[model samples]
Target chain A: MNEMIRSLENKPGLSTVGGIDCDLHPASPATKTLLPYLEEYWRETFVMRGVDRLSLAMTSSPSRAPINVRSDWKAESGFAGDTLEAVRTQALDPFGTRLAICNVLHGSMIMHSDDMAAALCGAVNEWLAREWLDREPRLRGSIIVSAQNSDLAVAEIEKRAADHRFVQVLILAQNDEPLGRRRYWPIYEAAARNKLPLCIHAGGSNRHAPTATGWPSYFVESYVAQASIFESQLLSLVAEGVFHKVPDLKVVFAESGFTWLPSFFWRADKTWRGVRAETPWLTEQPSDIVKRHVRFTLHPVDAPDQDALARTLEHIDCDDILLFSTDYPHAQFDGLNALPAAFGETLAKKILIDNPLATYPRIAADFQKEVAK
Target chain B: MNQAVLEKEKNAEAKLGIVDCDIHPAFGTPNELAKFLPQRWRDHLADYGQRSANPLVGTLPYPRMTPGNGMRRDAWPPNGGPPASDLAYLQEQLLDPLGIEYGILQPLAAGSSTLNQDLGAAMCAAVNDWQLDKWTGPEPRLKASISVAQEDAAAAIAEIEARIGDRSFVQIAIPPRTIEPAGRRRYWPIYEAAEHYDMPIGMHSAAFGWHTNSGAGWLNFYIEEHYAFSHSLQSVVTSMVFEGVFERFPKLKLIVVEGGFAWAAPLMWRLDKQWERMRSEVPHVKRPPSEYIRENVWFTTQPIEEPENNRHLLDTLRWVGADRLMFSTDYPHWDFDDPRYAFKVPLSPTERQQIFRENAKQVYRLP
Candidate 1:
């Protein structure tokens, strides 16, 4: 598949020195590729069940969608983001990324059985640690957890927390219930304790229709509708007292565009004003809480026009809310123009370096160590 | 007080407020609708009551953002009735005080999108009759929308045809969150009827209760659910454009009441981007989706997306075209937009006149 990902033959103009790319999706390795990492029991079960391969590709980003894989970026035979070489050439090296957080959205968490999900999650982490993190010191990974089982999810986080390479815990924006429900609080507790920011990327388990109504007819409807899901999850996080419960938890919304933030903040605050009594735990306005706790990747910069993009940023008000990302191998923007035009010198430095450092302590600590040396 | 005095009085009133495109007129009680239904269905109503798909019996599945299910706290009738029920209160408190020249009534009754098709039609007919007789007939400033159970196209058309000649009826109100996207051919008869009558379809945000607000699943909070309202409208707009509703009925006009207009610009841009790449899939769509949008659709400006700066709002208005925006108060809702201070942006007199009055006047063909 001759994909249209313009090769990064020349260095991009953006100054990305010591910049932390918040979101770079790595393709899930084939199940057979991960057999060595998995326990023998799980390996035997995979063969017995005839589950040789698994593709947890979300419908929202159908691999065939032009937006999903640019014609130039398409691999000849494998998934586009599978190899680290692609990330190095197309994303990290060109942009001069110091550290790029890898969020591996794979079929592991969506597995039917809880035990299988836990097993696959563990194997995926091991594979991520040994293959990607070890291969490139510039790369760090998100700890994938089987949100299907909270106990196992906590254990997985505990196991990965020891490795400083894991910067955050990965979850999808669309879960069976609101992610803030008490049932999922255990995972949050572990994430906070481990000092891993909870990263909820824009893909769901597909348990329900992507819209409030039933299924959407077109890919565009589903794609556009992702913004609403992000809003819902954000509200759920606030309204359900997730922030109140886990005060230390920081959230990174990768590929969750930031243009809608200002509007959402107003509406959420309005709702909070009216329904304050229902959720007594919410002490501050949603906008204030989101600004303090939430950070978003600057990919698929929803504002297509430069002027509107500038206005959206102005409306966002808080300077620290945006983290930089190339959204590697995904065809959100064309070529070296992965950075939206509005990211001038000051905003660019903050988004690419300062903001990420402030949000992720591990990266900041590592950068400090490098500076001292 | 002859012709000269009357002319002076009219000129004075014309300077008041712009057209209020989103006013909700509620029935004081179930008895209001019962009067118009046949005796048998009336008994059915009394026996079974309005069997909503939502589990909540007397109220909506989720509580609204406002104290009284998203209705304005002050909007509750001074007399013992639901908010927006008293005609005199509406006149004095809203229409008179706001200086509204024409107030479009959007009746969001329990059975507007009822599952029982025939019963739904009957309920809608009752709503229409009640709106005219109780509100529009008395207050000349108030206008009626031919409410319909859109799931049943033939009945909806019949209802539209029944009120087609009445000048008081300006538009056809369809549930925004319908069982199917509003553009399916199954619902084309209603659009055809709207075009035949030269009436624009009015899509206001009301719960159909047929499905959850999102394609995913039920929303847990009213705030989250409220956000889905705009998403629902966007989906309907996309459905209408891509499904060729505009192409099929080119002259058809669409007035999306209550749903904010800020999203229209970006949504259309996204559609045009996609259509450019995927035009072959929908060959019937003769023009770019945005072209159809600009020519056929107008949006109401209540629950306006207030970015921190007023300039952003103005830029959005410009993108969607000032001619495409109609001023709406959402008179009785908690998030109602007051015409005086609703738009934070500074507007030229012409821009104000077009958005507040002229756009709606042209769309509704109001005298």
Candidate 2:
């Protein structure tokens, strides 16, 4: 067992200094913690209804799952990433991350009531800004939005567009409907208008089972099945003409493993050739559109070994599509060996720093201002 | 020559033909299948009609892209029947030309995973009987799959028992998109029956299911829905591995047909990694998930993944052992692969033999 682990571990030469971590999960705030951030009317209603006592963490990442918390990183109480101080010392400091994007996975985003979902999502964004972004100089945030109502989702994106710290708009891969439906176009339009990339992370609303064939008995199945969810959503986005409509929209798939991309691209491109007339809006191949408009975060590198990872990267063929991420506090890897050993220094620099800056315009603008100063 | 050299030469000579594992054989006419069903079912088929979970009745909700109901352009027969409906046409178009010594029939009639359990089971039995009487009995090179509605364990087992000792039937055919993940205890009886009979279970990707094709939601275009086949199969593999189906039925063999094999290696890696962290949740999964998959699962190659770089395909094949892949053309389908041109990479003679003929022959115990 020890030998197997050692063989799978990334080679230790890559440096993390000044790298931009694309995906870091800050713990979902308990309802009690978000009371101050919520509007007065909603806050009062929450208190009156006793909703404040509930733990609003999404079920996608169960609190007890060993993969949710590394043994060394757990705090004295609650989840390891619950506090900004813990994140600063444990996630941001260890890797010397110049900028780490925080994607908060709260249950509020998946609520049944559209208005309530909107209200709670707003509060979570406010909480993220005040509690984490205001204190940490090196941290950035993703604006959490509920897609149950597109108007409400667009409003949230517009509200957070002014804040440079929120580099992208975050939505779940599995939602009430496929994210590429025309109903959700308003959200993408708003994202493009603001130059904020859409970040579809690995989690679901629990509206449906994580697998197409209904629910599995264990979290292990659900977690491993996330890659397929990502695949479906990507195909939806491309086939439903979301890219053609929102041409400027740069989509980032965070916490979605990239090893599946090569075969998926092949299948997508091959099928598109035979069925091109079905989606005439797509003038080019699906893989071409994906390569042009989409970027993937690196974590939970699902390859078996260095050689396999290298082959995957080679098959993917585009250097600009992968952005660096620690997937902080999620136990995707141990210590600072987040970047696989297959990457040489040049490719490592591109993935860790260059690709992220190019993907998120807001982050790049902030970097430009800092450079000018 | 020495004895070892003589044996090697003989083995090489014996490995000349191919075992095509995923040949879809359609009924010659709707009434042909109805003839095999009971009179009650035949009346129900005519009166209430054959219903599935999809909204559209008597047609697919998302129409297939290719003409002739998603068949290859040239596959439609001159006798005015749908592609693969006439065995003579199929033999002429695929088997004779591809040099297929043995062809396994996987009928995609949506009989195994439909919402109507009774109708599903009836349709499955009818398809099984039709395969034997119409195709396999007349053609010795062709073999039948014992079709069953997997949601009804008793019905599925009974169907298997009926065909237990028949050499005409090579394996049990189930749908990847079932009422539940293929691994749950609900489906264990069928697995036990397969094990007892020493028959492999073939999970061919089906088009109809109660749930949407994707985890996200119902898809919009045929392309997206077609791509969902791989995702559906991936979930089945994950479920079966983590749910300890293999641990409980160690000798049960699974041949995942039509879904490409490139994704298997990475999925196994991910499963093994997660099992190491979450083994307590599934204590019955005694060994690494990859070990069970490598031992119990076999994958068919059709709609084979065509990576831009041929070396990458070689890497995937190396990771997933060459011996684990069986050559399949998904015959008569729009995305059929010719055995001669499917693989872009140069394979050694041994690897080629294992993939094209030896592996399927061993798994199916074919003559």
Interface root-mean-square deviation, each candidate: 4.4, 1.3
Whole-model Cα lDDT of every candidate shown, in order:
0.79, 0.87
Residue A281 error, candidate 2, Å: 2.0
Q: Which regions in candidate 1 have their CA more than 4 angstroms from the true location? A: A1-13, B1-17, B64-70, B269-290, B307-312
Model number with the top DockQ: 2
Q: Fraction of native contacts in model 1? A: 0.22
> What is the C-alpha RMSD, rounded to one decimal, of candidate 1?
4.9
lDDT of 1 by residue, A98-143 (tens): 8999988777877768898899989989999999999999999999
Question: Which is the leading candidate under lDDT?
Answer: 2
Q: For candidate 2 chain B, which ten residues in a row score worst on lDDT?
A: B1-10
Off by over 4 Å in 2: B1-15
